[model samples]
Target: MKDHHQHELDSRYRRAALPPLGALRCFEAAARLGSFTQAARELHLTHGAVSRAVRSIEDALAVELFERRSQRVFLTAAGERLRDAAGAAFDVLAAAVRELREPPGAPALVLSCEPTLLMRWLIPRLPGFHARHPGIALRLVAGGGPVEFDGVDLAIRRDDFDWGRRVHAQRLFEERVGPVCSAGYRQQHLQGQGRGARWDDGAALLHSATRPGAWADWSRAARRRLPAGQNQSFEHFYFSLQAAVAGVGVAIGPWQLVRDDIDAGVLVAPMGFLADGSAYHLLSPRPIQAGSVGAQLLAWLCEQA
Candidate 1:
């Protein structure tokens, strides 16, 4: 009686558009391994069951996932693309499961900042940070502007920030600004154009729209002035640097953000006179413990500065 009812329920579900989760899993595994037998063994199911699951998934998606020939199943181009996405989904699911299984104790460290800052500055130094404090786990939350810090632990801010009633406040470090361009670009246009050359003397300046006064600052320091009719603007400093990298123009880059690029010989400064301080602040709701990872990060940035 139970088997009959189960069969009826399964038939009803099959009539619906929803494909079985097990079938999707089997297909993903089969595509990754390029063999039904291998997928069956890994999934602890019979080879026939695995093959049926793969076929079911392909039919549901209306896409050809594999091409079988000479007793071997090879994933199609579509299957290869799907495999990467499926694998990523599996990883996220597994991580979520693991987190649920573990007992929760300390609050997760949620770091909010711009994508450029995270990619160019923070990510490279994260290895040393992990080595020193394995207990601290980081969640990189990125955006163009600051999000309301309701659920966030800390913010690495470069914009206007209001402490309001928050208990946390510390200056991370100031970012020094200077002329930065690809080494190739520096050698080409800026080569014979050093201290003797006027700023407007055929120098292609990459303007950053975000930092309104960067050109003015650079012009003053370089002992030159931008022509009244000259105009160029980029949405962000990151994009401005990218333009500079492609030899489009010379950009004023923040030392804190592009230090590694400079060190790696990817970018170089023609004149070092533009290194002026612009503060970046570390903000949170409350003060961290003296020896905590938050404190460590603060200390590290200061030392780097």
Candidate 2:
């Protein structure tokens, strides 16, 4: 056994050369488990192979790694130092392997879209999309209003279908806005107030601040002569939705964002009269971007909506 082990670690082998991968592998495993026997078990080798690997490593390093006591092995100061270094080195190697294995496509996708869509629609389904498209990674920047899309790959927007010619938008789904309120709020303040009469008088109107002029457009389309605007408003749809869900006030938001709420009975669109048919869009500076892999994502979104 001694002669065979000596043959394995030749004296002619240069110690200053790069360390052996198999020996480093054995060391990392043993360091992680803190037991050579466990490392041998995991690596599917006999305890002798693991011990030999460790011995070869120690010989190469010209360092004392362990103080053997009975059957148990303890890491010396030098072993502890090498363990830390080897762990970090393995982590870097694993990262490099992952990068090399990644498929070819866009390095990163910058998605700028409405806060409402980001939270309500897009985010919830992102994990599934990632599972299917492992090669693509998305970095989302949720901002209300026109994002300086100079560096962005794509922007998901909510606007009228006829958005002029400055920017190109692919129509995804037309949104319909109406009085969205919690079930409790409708029971308290809105039950049987008569169609249009409830909103005609002041009834704690929670206006969405993102779409300031939106209430007016809704009122006009529905021919609702609103007597007063209570002006309990919020800039973000997520906030306004929460407020409405909490039975604070009646908020006006897109059907797409509030669709789940309406379905789950968290909210109810009291008067469907406010449906204006404003479509959500995927806006891009150059329309040709829609033809890229990101465009495939857009196509999926349009189908889902």
TM-score, one value per model: 0.60, 0.58
Clashing pairs in 2: 174-279
Stretches of candidate 1 off by over 4 Å are: 1-105, 144-147, 159-167, 191-194, 197-200, 227-231, 273-277
Candidate No. with top lDDT = 2
lDDT at 177, model 1: 77
Using alpha carbons, what is the TM-score of model 1? 0.60
CA lDDT of every candidate? 0.70, 0.72
Question: How far off is residue 144 in model 1, in Å?
Answer: 5.6
Residues 1-305 of candidate 1 have per-residue lDDT tens digits of: 56988998988887685567788799888887878899999999999999898788788789988888999987664665466446545644654564456577565677776666765677567667657766666555665444467777777776444446654667776656777777766555553465664344456777877777887886776666564444568877767776666666688888777778788786777666454545677777778779887787678656655
- The parts of candidate 2 lying over 4 Å away from their true place are 1-106, 160-166, 193-202, 227-229, 289-291
Instruction: Return the TM-score for candidate 2, rounded to 2 decimals.
Output: 0.58
lDDT for model 1: 0.70
> Which candidate number has the best TM-score?
1
